[model samples]
Target: MKSKGFTLIELVVVIVILGILAATAVPKFINLQRDARIASLDGFVGALKAANSIVMSKATIVGIKSAKVETNIPNTDLYVLDGHMSIKPEHIKAAMNIEGFMVTNYALTMTRTTFVYLADKELTMPELRALNCFIHLTRSYTQQDGSNVIDTGDLKVNEFYDGC
Candidate 1:
């Protein structure tokens, strides 16, 4: 009588095919987390740029030389967009209008004049916390024709991709 089951050779061949497929698929899956982190960082950068532009426009309309607009968060000092004052971590959160998300999802650390990101332990890998990722905002004064002019510093992202 002929057997109605797969032969040992046939079973081994099927297993080999599955293994090859898995080997190719696993890399794509592993990269998903990195891609997601990169996207999140990019989104945050876009938000920062948008917020800065809005604040600057408002300041210009109000005839203020500096970013002296009220923030979304109460009891926080006004953000000086003209670079007269260094932006604080709270200022950044308020400017981005993502205080709730930041509070719930990530830890913000202030080092000198830079804001650093640390992923929450419950939601992210410990390696992310050790990565050097930060944003820096600085403002300086320059003398132009014997007059002091405030020069706004651009926002800089450092080691953002390294963490991802």
Candidate 2:
């Protein structure tokens, strides 16, 4: 007479296989969040670079000497200054899908010779959210003697967006 289930080795082998599969699959899933964050950061950097190029190019013709970029309060889209431009949040949203994806919280400082932009992004799980962006502007003036001087240090960022 033989009993039905006396196979400890079989159970152990099954458990080992399961563990191996889990070990391999878990890491890939966990890494997805990190990839999303990197993508978001890249997009932001690209947009900032684009805007900087635009400002520098147009300044000479517009007599903009120096200017700061601003946005509507409590939002990322709808830029104001010279004209309005639309910024699509979808790219960011797709990457992070954070709770509050509409607002931007970062700061910017600019001069005819230099411009600085910074963002305080809060990461949740795999998502990133921005707080605010402030900007400052300075102007450069050239003298007939071929001397260049930088003037006007008015660092102002118009009200726009809430910290979500």
Question: What TM-score would each prediction reach against the true structure?
Answer: 0.62, 0.36
Candidate topping lDDT: 1
Report residue 159 deviation for candidate 2 (angstroms).
Answer: 22
lDDT of each: 0.52, 0.39
Residue 88 lDDT in candidate 2: 27
Cα shift from native, residue 46, model 1 (Å): 1.2
Q: Mind giving the per-residue lDDT tens digits that candidate 2 earns over 20-71?
A: 9999999998677555554544454455445545543444344443333433
Which run of 10 residues does model 2 get worst, by summed lDDT?
A: 155-164
Candidate 1 residue lDDT tens string, 31-71? 99777766766666677677777665555555553443322
Instruction: Tell how far residue 139 is off in model 1, in angstroms.
Output: 5.3
